[model samples]
Target: MNAAVLTALIALVSSVVGGAIVAAVNHHYSVKEDLHARRLDLSVDRLSEAYMFMLLNLTIDKDKHREYQIHLANIQLFGSPTTVSLTNNLMRRQAGEPVDVTTGALLSDILNSIRNDLGLDRIDTADLVRLNLGDEVDLLKRESSK
Candidate 1:
């Protein structure tokens, strides 16, 4: 090939290679980000479901407290350390291990974890504090009544 043709060919080859590299790198990053987001969504979903079961467990008439534990255990597979700690408090409370915590506190921790995982701003304290205090109180009373 002539010099000009050869130079043009080299330039085209380099451009194609560079473009491919960039695209591959971009795809790698996008996939990584997508996986991270999906994991977080799963964790939040699990936590939300667990919170529901926790509420059901609170009702003295129900016997689904043990089922509530399924969500908590699943969180361990996908949640961060803070999430695990918060769930542990609930476990302790259910076991009547004299934990110095309340339903509101556990709720707060779960809400905070969900918020953090979703990359949301700080939650309003007033909203988090509105949890009915009856669950923990009732659990205590039930223990004594038993």
Candidate 2:
């Protein structure tokens, strides 16, 4: 074979191999990203489930709101138990240590925002345990309806 034709053949093979390697890497990275997203989704689901359970408890007994609130406080503290910072006013009094009112308010806002994102209207203690959070809750119910 001519030298040029031989050189071209080698280059073609190299290109094909390089493309395959790149595609495999891209696919691996994409799967990793999807796994991360799934983990985050699971975390959100767990948090929502806990909230709903608390709501159910509150609905069953009027005076159980405080107990449910305590459960929520524990959930918040699970990651940063010694942070000495409160996220919501309702959680402040349950803190094991002193808390900053402003930080607590900010946290309250963040929690409320999450609830709003999940289609919750209000966070009243009376309705906390037994209220429908709208479409998001409906979707969850349908998913588990089986």
Candidate 3:
């Protein structure tokens, strides 16, 4: 082939190869990022659900305080908040978000106190406190489900 035709063929081949590489990289990274985002979303959803359940339980009979405490403990073990692990900016973004760490901890404390004052043995004050104020929320429900 003439020089111009050979040069054109090389350019076309290079363009196709470059496009494929770019697409592959983007697809691979995007899928990984998407998985991470979905995981975070799921975590947030579960945390919110736990908070709602606790709120609903509180609206029940005060005589069921022990049961409610157990439920709170279960939420603690299950919906443990992990938002604290997020950066300050992300946490700030959650400023308007309900079921925050402070609030969750307070709820746990009140439940533990009511349970203890009622002479309940199935519950632990420190565990309740830790579960409430502890580190990032864990996938406690998944662990318990097994």
Model 1: residues >4 Å from true position, as ranges?
59-62, 124-146
Segments of candidate 3 deviating more than 4 angstroms: 58-146
lDDT of 3 by residue, 26-117 (tens): 99999999997776565445444545555444244768767655544444443424322322222343456543244334344444433433
Question: Which residue pairs clash within candidate 1?
Answer: none
Best by TM-score: 1
- Summarize candidate 1's per-residue lDDT along 60-113 as a digit string, tens digits: 334654565566687666566766776677578768887655655555567677
State the weakest 10-residue window (summed lDDT) of model 3.
82-91
- lDDT: which is higher, 1 or 2? 1
The clash numbers for all candidates, in the given order, read 0, 1, 3
**Backbone clash total, candidate 3:** 3
lDDT of 3: 0.49
Please provide TM-scores, in order, for all candidate models, with all chains considered together. Answer: 0.72, 0.46, 0.43
| TM-score result, candidate 1 | 0.72
lDDT of 2 at 103: 29
Looking at model 2, report the run of 10 residues with the lowest lDDT sum.
Answer: 78-87
The Cα local distance difference test for each model comes to 0.66, 0.50, 0.49
